[model samples]
Target chain A: MSIKLTILEQMTQVAREQGRTLAPLRDDLALLDSGLDSLGIAVLVARLEDRLGTDPFTNSEDVHFPVTLGDFVKAYENGAP
Target chain B: MALPEALSLRRHVAETQADRFLFDRAARIRIADLVRGTSLDGDPTALHGRSVLIATASQLTSALTLIELDGNARRLTILPPDIDGAHLGALIADAGIDAVVTDGETPHGLHDIPLHVACMPKVVPIDRGRPEHVRTEWVLLTSGTTGVPKMVVHSLTSLTAAIAPRADSDPLVWGTFYDIRRYGGLQIFLRAMLGGASLVLSSAGEPVAEHLLRLARHGVTHLSGTPSHWRRALMASAIGSISPRYVRLSGEIADQAILDNLRAAFPQAAIGHAYASTEAGVGFAVDDGLAGFPASYLEGGCGATEIKIVEGSLRMRSAALAARYAGARGASLRDSDGFVDTGDMVERRGDRYFFVGRKGGIINIGGLKVHPEEIEAVITRHPQVRMCLVRSRSSPVTGALVVADVVLKPTCVREEGRAQVKDEILELCRGALARHKVPASIAFVPELAVAATGKLARLS
Candidate 1:
């Protein structure tokens, strides 16, 4: 499976588990406004680390914080060793 | 009557009130018979005035051996079961152990001792020899880092200094989830022995349910263990089987959540948490059903022990403190003015001081220092959470990241709603803890491993 699909699947699962309905999974959708708080983002990153075997945030020192779904997916894909 | 220079366990047994028994899982021996019967093989007089080590497999025999050898041996070292076998040689040489006592096989590296007396758990009736009146030094091993444990020297006088004889204590039965070789459990053992109360000893590998059943069978009115031990007992179905009047927690931070949970579980019991260490002796016990001790304890001489906060670390001074670290451990157990530095760090809020964590147990996140226990105390406050262990995981972004493994209350275990509960717990942490201290992720665990010391298995 592609990293984008896996991230979306986990994000949907995490959102559903948290009893939050996700809006459409668009590239421009702001992650903070997509029914997931900082904690949810953290849980997502952890789950992604487990499923994808890479944590983009920990991969590099100068990596920018992802603000949108596209940026989040790009970080993981580019950071994958 | 004035207390003697050295209050021997043998002399205490002779003076104890009649009709008290010490119960292990398999056997119960009347305290009087302990003084009358012999568990030591061959001539017991051969051990008189020699340094000895009590390294028994079972706590019962250790207790039995301790009572017999206290005054007879010039020095008695109570070795806890969890001590690394590799350190035994150095420990033997350090303690000047000329003789060793064991219930079963002799401990490795100590077989060459001049006297290796085999002890039996059950005492046999034999004409007891004359009691030795010599003052014996009681040496207790302090939990240490990877090296051999530090041996703290104490006489019977210093050990029993905190135990005050009660008028109505004869009918009470005492029990503990600690191995009597450790300082915490040894305190309970000494209290029962000196106060003439029957004691229920906990054996290694005994399940919580079985231990509770034995405690119930023995009518344990006062029970003591670490907060981790109590957390496991609270989860056991057999917890409802025992109704103790006094419940005590020590050896770990007793947060308000655990105190409240214990109060809810046994409403009729008086719950308290004490501050003590192998070196500090008995600091003080807080019985107000609160987490930390009252700030008033920091004032001049609260009870027998004096408490002072020196640079955020708790320091105590009292007659109950150990004499000094035995052998050439280099560092003195106390400062120049006679204060044992209990490495527990505490923060004062309002009128009470709460334990943050150990001085050495801190984790560095990015550049900020965080105590795992400080976060655990917050996460455990959630209604659905029973217990939690916060630890550090290596991360490239932040050097180290905080994570938690939590055990939810049995009643609140709903698989479908676990994610919701996790979110709520995160929110709880976010509200109370700092941004960096908040756990990055929380995993639900069925149980947490507790060490032989009755503390959370932090290293594991």
Candidate 2:
């Protein structure tokens, strides 16, 4: 069994497409290791939503997810609808 | 039952910049004296016998400002700022103020104290046969939300219609989360003055729960609270404490949760929310605080209000409307219907409408719409963080990104260096926010700038 489109993998794809290098935020979180700030997060979410056809920036979910560097990255990939 | 003599009201007409003004109404009058004029030591029982009603200078300017004359078939609006004493003196000489009520506040530049005045209590009776519309009666100023205070002229008929149904005169005690000087406050104070109700003013930062208990102690039945005030009440609210008999929420959105809380707080009380503006008065359909405003924009049977949702915004046509703004006439947000467009954004879920946020507060980062209030709500959920500002700043690549400035909760302040709290606050935000929504920078400020009037300057 394998996880297709894990949070880290998706974040990497989006960051790469934008021509920006995402420095490793953590080995465990994989892609979200970049520790992008608020503006960075907003830009990434908007771009991710455009590419994946889902909302990554909603008020309700943002209140709960992204507690850890890895958790935030995972939530983005898993949470988008 | 004889009404209290102190409950009687009077008016004074003063020249702008004059320490002295003419009292329009005389002192207290007996039933027998009602037929006659100025029976109390030759003084009319109009001015409510108060030596002076201290108010802000702008209030005095509103009084001498303009007046409407009844002699003309139509409303003769004469309410203009007396502006200067020279102009007021000329008007006094012109016999123009035959019947005028002075604004409660003394005019501008009148630092002199021990203000003396009398009234024309008999003037209304003398002119009783004249229609109220034809008679010059009341005056008001705009809410000053748009930066400049404007004079919104109104007659007793227009102003009273908006407030009569909502007034708590039968019991006399009214509780609300509005400034006494604002429109909501004006209605309450005017009713309190007219009905002999005790005015209970709340001090800042006092838990609203305590205030509710005080109102209950005074046998208060009516209640009101704004959005921010409601949020504070939510913060201060315990499971079951003080319950009001009737609650009114206004000045912002009233959703189902708010309605539920008010209902729970005041189980038997009728809860109502209203849609009104300074220009529109208390116009629009009566909201039960249970649903979005009426599905149809325009509603009748509520009062003299006409309401409509134009282009996702609420616009209203009101007979209780104010005449005009006082200062320089700034850009008008008035729609084609002459209905002013209040900048609130509304969404329709079936027949129910929900308010999202203000249109002006909407932040567009590269055309992606984000409401700062939405983001701030998320940040506030973290216990370690208190209030937070989620705003967008110019960025070269992403167009813009959300940046946050936050204050640590009092409990978060520890003896360990500030670094610990900062780290905790940052950790909390990072966990809560998404990649795009996380603050690029979360700086702790000693305190956010709060206005003297008690509203946050989000844009400023």
Candidate 3:
């Protein structure tokens, strides 16, 4: 599966577990504002790190918290082995 | 009555039992040698009444120089060697530091003051200037839960009031996971010195297994670490071979499972966990093979310290409280009765009170509150689980939901066994925790990252 698809799937799974239904995933959607709060972002980051085998947020010296879905996917893509 | 000078204790130890102080990796350093090597005997007038910052990278050198400076009447502030240049500048400005004594390169923007490294042995005779002792202050930085590290002011008297003098013959080889700059680590460092016991310093940047091996080689009988540190050390194969006489846990809540595991591992060791903070100083230690102190300790049973529960949180009053928070404009740390709110939530479990979690970290889950530590304790009880972290996950329906990240034991890494272990962990949580407390999701990680202070990095 594509990394972006896997990210969306994990987000959906986390949203469903939290008993909230998320809208269809889009690249420009603001993660912090898109129904998921800081905690949700944290869970999503952890899930992505597990599936993708790398955590971009921790790898960089100057970590930029991903504001949108595209930036979040880019972090994983940039850090991919 | 005026308190005894901080250096006087060291002098007495050096005079009587010079051969028994610290056991570094390469050699056993005596108190007499430490005093002679670091003492400012050449120009006492230069450092008199000056505020000094001790920021050495080596724990042994830091401890030695801290004692030397404090003994010489130089006001002292301890900064971790790895403190960022900006943070160091801020701390120096906040504390109004005059001079810094360090082995590391002086940070930029602070090139005005004198930086003294560990000096070679000087043969000048010790001069006893007038018997009057200067009022000295030891400033320590708070762990900075609020992102701004507050400087806590303490006197040598207040810091050492609880430590009882130990006989010279008592055999003690101390080891600690905390850096000497931290309040928890300072307690062990001071305790070892006060007792004239030998201590094995754990060097920073070394592997846990290697440090444990060094301690074992030095015959470390008394050891202390945070629960997370202990869990990691337990995972290390070298830990089983090291026999400690006294095991202590601090820096985080000591759950029952860790305590039980330690007790089972070292049956002869006296297991104790202390609840102490930078502002609160040393509170109390529970030696019983339980998670929390007995309920009776709240009523002045724990020496000079007094404990009370206010608004479901623990508050304490003691002679050992930090004098005041530095640079805090008119901020009061205590109430009229001298009780400082600890900001830690406690739940009464029958006769004992157990720490639920920090008040600030409480997860509000659709009107039900859950503490991540409680969930972590339950999750960590599984034999296959090496370490676990529990945190709140944001939810649209509920304000937050419980989530966990677990690190399994190495033996449980088989693909088929991993699935079964996860199921078993979920089952264990369901049986042990409340419905809302059970984690909604559990992610397995290879290893958990630990902070520089040797604590599990919590999601902030």
Candidate 4:
């Protein structure tokens, strides 16, 4: 239960902070490799920099970046500064 | 030798090779015992030859070699740029020769080059040389266009010698047939020519729709491209177009969807793409994907070969190696066992190898090896930048300078307080990165300048 909530908490906080109260879980937690267009990715990158306190990345044509909130957090921990 | 030495005329090397040997696909025109006194056609009296610049795909090394051995001509073959739309003038001026043998003209943006006064290009020939003897050596130019391009020369003997043994793979192999001008295109050309398969030439400057039109018209059994190329081609097919007998991806990785797409497109045409280099010589192992993407490999003893990763760079022994960089100091590139270091970085995965970025792609910022993609990723994170490019430029104190060319987000209006976005971006990188990894300079352009096909141009 604790692990599952820890995983769910980031999305919960992002939704509350952005005032996007009822947005679907799948939309908020999309992966980097999947097919998000340019504008959608820009929003995700901005939110990541704000939440993670790490500098956001330049845009890429290659990967979509990670989608799941847990996956994004993990990538945040491991990614270069 | 009865051959017309190059100091005479400037044209196809075939014209100069009077008595030595003749190699067109499988049509052998060797100088027989009684034919030693003859000269090849175009035996010009003014052997103070016109200059010729050759530009065929890398796999045409066999034809190139046949030219080198038979015709005593001084031909200048220009190198292809890594990201496309690069200049051939510096290369032209460096060599001081005439006439060029290049892939068709479109990829080169040939007319933009006004300085190229002596430029003459020969398209990749669609004919075949005889089975026993090899004919041309297609020289390959590396991606870096800043200095004289790294020349990977291959010869006719080395190119054609591997034909018979590998020919059995036939219509079953995944990548043996593609456009002869593409890096992998030339490989397929050589494979098909050596194996006795018919060559189907593609129409120049055609879109995916046009490509499928040609494919249907020519009854094309096989198709090949980079990952991006494969994706676009496959997407185009969804609208009901390109259906080849075979499908393969080279020049880049084939991920999960790419593999699935190939299997779906040419269920009967063997599906595969080989990871090869001009230095490594084609013919490597086929990988089964574990991650979202599959890796590549070259089998043990595929040819007279050996592989090494010295200081994290890939090197190989290709019997079909070309001799020297045309105008550089005349030094040979043979190793102790005659294997050349390919300069590609690789990681071992069981018995296979995966491709990484180039060694030169590593930007050394304050004694750090920072991949440009890493920095570019951060810049892209700013919801305001649309596209980004990272490259090393001139630096006085630090050996090389890092510069970023960026296209801002569509909503970010260019006028009235837009300049603050640059500072915000610099501040963002300053917070997340070390001092050096931050770009020394940044250029905010309207749009990123890329080729017609979507490859990023690193060098101007």
Residues B162-278, model 4: lDDT tens digits: 334433434422232234443455555555444434444333344666656545544455566655455445445432454566565665434344565456566655665555655
Model 2 lDDT per residue over B30-93, tens place: 2222222221222222322222222322321222122112111122223223233333333332
Tens digit per residue, CA lDDT, model 3, B173-292: 889988878888898888887776777877878888998899998888899989989989988999987999899999899998899888888999999999898888888888888997
Candidate 3 wrong stretches, greater than 4 Å: A1-81, B1-9, B25-28, B35-45, B114-132, B328-330
Candidate 2 — which residues are off by over 4 angstroms?
A1-81, B1-139, B143-147, B164-172, B190-199, B202-213, B234-241, B255-257, B285-288, B297-304, B327-336, B374-400, B403-459
TM-score of chain A of 1: 0.94
Give the candidate number with the greatest TM-score: 1
Per-residue CA lDDT of model 1 for B297-371, tens digit only, reads 888636888888998999999888999888877377888788999999999999889999999999887678989
- DockQ value for model 3: 0.06
For candidate 4, the lDDT comes to 0.47
TM-scores of the candidates are: 0.90, 0.55, 0.82, 0.51
- Chain A of candidate 3: what's the TM-score? 0.88
In model 3 chain B, which range of ten residues has the least summed lDDT? B116-125
lDDT of 2 by residue, A11-75 (tens): 56545533467776573553334745444555555545545655444534434535456565555
Q: For each candidate, what is chain B's TM-score? A: 0.97, 0.59, 0.92, 0.55
Model 4 alpha-carbon drift over 4 Å, by segment: A1-81, B1-51, B55-138, B161-182, B238-243, B283-303, B329-337, B363-460
Output the worst ten-in-a-row residue range by lDDT, candidate 1 chain B: B1-10
Ranking by TM-score: 1, 3, 2, 4
